[model samples]
Structure formats: C-alpha cells, structure tokens
Target: GALVYQYPRRTICKSGTSMRMECQAVGFQATSVAWYRQSPQKTFELIALSTVNSAIKYEQNFTQEKFPISHPNLSFSSMTVLNAYLEDRGLYLCGAREAGDAEQFFGPGTRLTVL
Candidate 1:
C-alpha cells in the first residue's frame, strides 16, 4: 500500500516572501517522490523528483534557487518556494511512487495564495 499526504492544505503568503510544505508517505517505502505545481491555467508543471542515493532531477524553469527540496528518507519529503509572486501561486502537489510500482500516489496538495 502506498499513500502520500501533504500539509497546510491551504496557505496565504505575501509577495516576495516564502512558504514551506511537507509530504508524508504511508504504508510502504517511497522510492521516488515528485513535486508539481498546478498553475491557474490548469497545467501541471513538474518541479522536481527525488530518489534515494540519486541526484534530484528538476524540470525546466524550476531550479533549486527558486524551489528547494529535501528528501530525508524513503517516507518523507519537503519543499519550499523561496519567493512568493502572482505567478507562483498554485496547488503544490506531492506524488510518491512506491518501490516496484508504476503509479505514483498523490497527496491532497497545498493551495497557495499570494497577496
């Protein structure tokens, strides 16, 4: 069994500030975890993916400077957006792909509002 959980559910941040979010895994080991941001346009943008002992892979337009990630163990991960802006506002989702599984289980996501 694989399950992913995200925290804060919703948040409001001031422009130019930052916000942190967490992801937790339940039932089994999370071999890989992916972070995504769903834009206002309804497009899901990949932020990064972390695998044990391997380098984190970040997608285009996403960098460690703007979005930093931490995968402390097989069952947990966290990410933070360093700056809050109008364009940065979105639903942040974390998906955990369990060992030997083809599907990635997703969390409820963290909805962000920039003011």
Candidate 2:
C-alpha cells in the first residue's frame, strides 16, 4: 500500500508571494511523483511529474520558472508556487507512484488562498 502525505493542508498568502508544499511517500518506493492543481469548478490539471534519476516534466502552462519541483529520492518530493496570485488559488495535490503501479497514491492536498 502506498500513501502520500502532504503538508500545510491549507494556507493563505498575500498576492505576489510564494508557498512551498512537501509530499512524502510511505509503504512503497515512489518511482514518480506528479503534481496537480484542482482549481475551483475546473478539473484537475497536471502541473508536473518528477521521476527518479530523470528530468522533471512540466505540463503546458506550467514551467520550472513558476512551479519548481524537487524530487531528491524515491520517497520524497516538493514543489513551490512562486509569486502566488488569484489565478493560482487551488487545491494542490501530490500523487506518488511506484514502479509498475497502475495508479498513483494521492495526498489530501494543500489548498491555496490568495488575497
């Protein structure tokens, strides 16, 4: 069984600031970590995916410049939402997957609030 734990379940920051969130994988080796954002009234958007020993892949509209990711090992990952704004408000989720796993284990997610 794989489980992902995300920290700072909810947070609020003034506009033009940055916020960092962490994810930890337990009960299995996480070969890949995917970051997603579920904005209000919209479906989940794939932010980025980080694989061990490989480059971090960012989806369209997302970049390392704005959402930097760090996957140092098999069980840990982190990402930062740089210069947060109203458009960045959403539920940031972390999904960790092990080798050969069909599905990823998702954390509760960190909700972002910008004012």
Candidate 3:
C-alpha cells in the first residue's frame, strides 16, 4: 500500500514567523504532489503542485514567494509556510499521486497556529 507521511503534526508560531514541514511517499513513485491549506473555517485552498522534473505550478492566490516547495525526488517533498499570521493558521496537507492518476492520497496534515 502507498502512504504519505507528514511530520510535526502541529506547530505554533508568532504572527511573523515561519515553519517548515515535510512529506514522504512510501510504496509508490510520487510523480506529483499537491499542497493545500484548510483554514479554521473549514475551507480548503489548493496552494501548489510539484511534479518531478517539471516546473511547479501555483494556484491563483498562492505564489512561489509565499509558499515555496521543494521536490528533490520522486518519494519526498517539503514546503515552508513563510511569515506566519493569524490568517495563515490552518491545516496543511500534502497529497501525492502516481504518474497516471489524477487523484492523490493525502497525509493527515500539519496544523499550524499563529498568535
């Protein structure tokens, strides 16, 4: 079975800080990874997508400058939440997919809190 794992289930930071989280894919070659943010309001936003050997694509409200992603290999990826803020507090999820499937398997996610 394939699985994606994210570390440090939860984190708390100041209003102007940052946090880094990791995602690792096991039992599959994760060709693409999609990053998403779920706010306290329960709204989910697609942040970006990272594909192996291809340029990363960011969604409309997201940018490389704000949510930078690192996809060094087929099995692992990471992202940093820069400049933590009250509005930036949310659950960050990493979804991994194989080469052919448009669907992705998501990790439990890392919950972030800003104060």
* Predicted model with the maximum TM-score: 2
Give the 10-residue window scoring lowest on summed lDDT in candidate 2.
96-105
Per-residue lDDT of candidate 2, residues 43-78 (tens digit): 999999899999999999999999999999988999
RMSD of each: 1.2, 1.0, 1.1
Off by over 4 Å in 3: 100-102
What lDDT would each prediction earn against the true structure?
0.91, 0.94, 0.91
TM-score, candidate 3, is: 0.95
- In model 1, which runs have C-alpha deviations exceeding 4 angstroms? none
After superposition, which runs of candidate 2 have C-alpha atoms over 4 Å from their true positions?
none
C-alpha displacement of 76 in model 3, angstroms? 0.7
- Model 2's alpha-carbon lDDT is 0.94
Which lDDT tens digits does candidate 1 get at residues 1-115?
Answer: 6778899899999999999999999987788999999988797899998997788999999999999999989999999999889999999999998764668899999999999
